[model samples]
Target: MLLMNEKIKASEVALTGLRGEDLGIVGREEALAMAREAKVDLVCTSLLSSPPPCKLVARGAAKQTDAQEKKAERIQGGAVKTKELRLTAHIEEHDYETKLRQAEKLLTSGHAVQLTVKLAGAKEGERAKALIDRMLKELAPHGTRETGIQVSGKQAAVKVNPA
Candidate 1:
């Protein structure tokens, strides 16, 4: 946080900055006086330096910028949520279609879809792969595949995102 004018704690601060006037390292009292004369705030930009780095900027500008950034994040979904759907090795056609619709809805709502099928026996791998492939094919109109089938141990998974 940047302190304004009298609120500055450092006795002396490195006032030299790339964007503002070069006051170099000066007493806090003098910096406060300079900020008053310039009608700006004496802000402590860095507290880690030996004398601390301070800058002069218009009051409330930093807070306004921070608020704007937060607003933008809220507008953009901050972070995408991953929706996982697990399928059985032998799902009926109707049940598979229902699951596909659910995955499509998730993608359209700006969420990533994770479809997984776990095989208990080696012979069940083909069936799992087939189910994964069919899901991808049906979901093509609603989303794009972000990841192809990824197999680890006996589980195979895929990822999709809204188009």
Candidate 2:
């Protein structure tokens, strides 16, 4: 989840989204108090900001408006945007099937899935490669990779699109 804070305080100087660096330690009420003390409304700058939280301030009549904005955002992003599913090198059949089912659900809705694999050592690397290979095969039968598998240290990611 991400919090957005847009300072729309024209009547007064608002400091919106002041909880980016200090996220997780503050709540809406706390944020509101922080904004109110600062004389502004808490507006979300980037609700889905990779870090998962952001806030700002503006002096306006947007009290608890963050609720509405967040709700709307949740509905939109939650239902529409891409979703990811994770699998380890030694993932079992039932677990793989489950995650695949979930990924298929998202893909059927025109959403992308980022298949991520985590590895440990050389032995784990071989297992990771094997798991990734099998996943690619399964996905190939039903989907295609828009982005090829990429490795970032011990993790590999590929963007899959439904066929």
Candidate 3:
């Protein structure tokens, strides 16, 4: 959680200016006054540090920066990539083979695969599930089924992870 502007209650804070310059430790009131003068917000960044580190940020930029940092972390943190493949219940054999190859390639490259089979009618649900089961069987060597067939109103889905 972030405490901004007047919501910050620490008596003193280690401040950093808006331009990323260190402003050193200062009184909380002084930091708030500087933020007010600069027409920005006083945000407490690290409440656990000595004097509680604070920084000057434009209104709403704190959350934006946090989101950007999280996105960067996710990209750099070896997050697993999930690829979705959509199919129809009555797919052609050639198309099925193509999709199977694509899935196998994805699994070989350490990506998770979500297989979705769309049903044209209520009666097609069983066929879609059977198709997924057959695909899972064929993909057993390349990947392991992470989830059983999940049938919603008009779609059946399954998840597979690399072996």
Badly placed stretches (over 4 Å) of model 2 are 1-80
Error of 1 at 105 (Å): 1.2
Q: Predictions ranked by lDDT, top down?
A: 3, 1, 2
RMSD of each: 11.1, 15.2, 11.7
Of the pair 1 and 3, which is ahead by lDDT? Answer: 3
Count of clashes in candidate 2: 20
Q: What C-alpha lDDT values do all the predictions have?
A: 0.79, 0.62, 0.91
Q: What TM-scores do the predictions have? A: 0.51, 0.46, 0.53
Best by TM-score: 3
| Model 3: lDDT to the true structure | 0.91
Error of 1 at 53 (Å): 46
lDDT of 1 by residue, 109-147 (tens): 677889999778778877898889988988888778888
Please identify model 1 stretches exceeding 4 Å from their true place. Answer: 1-76
For residue 148, give model 2's deviation from the true position in Å: 2.0
Determine which window of 10 residues in candidate 1 has minimal summed lDDT: 66-75
Clashes by residue pair, model 3: none
What tens-digit string does per-residue lDDT give for candidate 3 at 1-163? 7689888888899999999999999999999999999999999987788799899999789988887776556546796788999999999999999999999999877788999999889999999999999999999998898888999998999999877
